[model samples]
Target: MDSPSTPRWRKSSHSNGDGGSCVEVDDANPGHVRDSKDPNGPSLAFAPSAWNAFVSAVRDGEFSGI
Candidate 1:
């Protein structure tokens, strides 16, 4: 799908200053994820509901320490 117009990238709050596994997300269009190290690289877009579910899972520690 076409990239959203001028997506405003926001750095993840969980990102450490050492730059180890950082992620950037586009709030302009929810569910869009791009690597912080490669802003111009490909992005993964998910449906809003799916994204919410994924976030919920993360919050619930469904995928922890793996």
Candidate 2:
């Protein structure tokens, strides 16, 4: 995992103003995800391909109504 200090973390645009159900991603390094509510907590990293697939599934609503 990359050092959290150097990573450029950005909150999702979809994030609520009150900070509910939000995620943060580090564009400085691809494939890293951290909870917006817990910036110092552990992050989950994925391969670029895997991350794309995950995003595609999300856009397609594969997990809708779950």
Candidate 3:
């Protein structure tokens, strides 16, 4: 398990200025995701391949208007 301090969180570039929806990621751990609104809350981690697939889908507009 990664220590609480291990992952350096970065807010998504796609995050809106209004702060309605926010996503944060740990680039060091390509599979980890946490809410920017709750840094200390539970997070979800995906497998490397799964994360890649998800990112690809997003880039391809598979999840547009979401």
Preferred candidate (lDDT higher): 1 or 3: 1
The 10-residue segment of model 1 with minimum total lDDT is 1-10
Using TM-score, give the best candidate's number. Answer: 3
Ranking by lDDT: 1, 3, 2
lDDT of 1 at 9: 94
Could you tell me every candidate's TM-score relative to the true structure?
0.80, 0.72, 0.84
- Residue lDDT tens for model 2, 1-66: 545456889987756788797988888777788998988799998888998898889889998776
> Tens-digit lDDT track for model 1 on 1-66?
766777899998867799888898888988999899998899998998999998899899888887
Winning candidate number (lDDT):
1
TM-score of candidate 2 to 2 decimals: 0.72
The residue-by-residue lDDT of candidate 3 on 1-66, one tens digit each, is 654457878998878989867999998788899989998899998988999999999899998886
Q: Which stretches of candidate 2 lie over 4 Å from their true place?
A: 1-5
RMSD of each: 2.5, 3.1, 2.5
Compute the lDDT for candidate 1.
Answer: 0.88
Q: Superpose all Cα atoms of candidate 2 onto the true structure and report the RMSD in Å to 1 decimal.
A: 3.1
Model 3 ranges with Cα > 4 A deviation: 1-5
Question: Is 2 or 3 the stronger prediction by lDDT?
Answer: 3
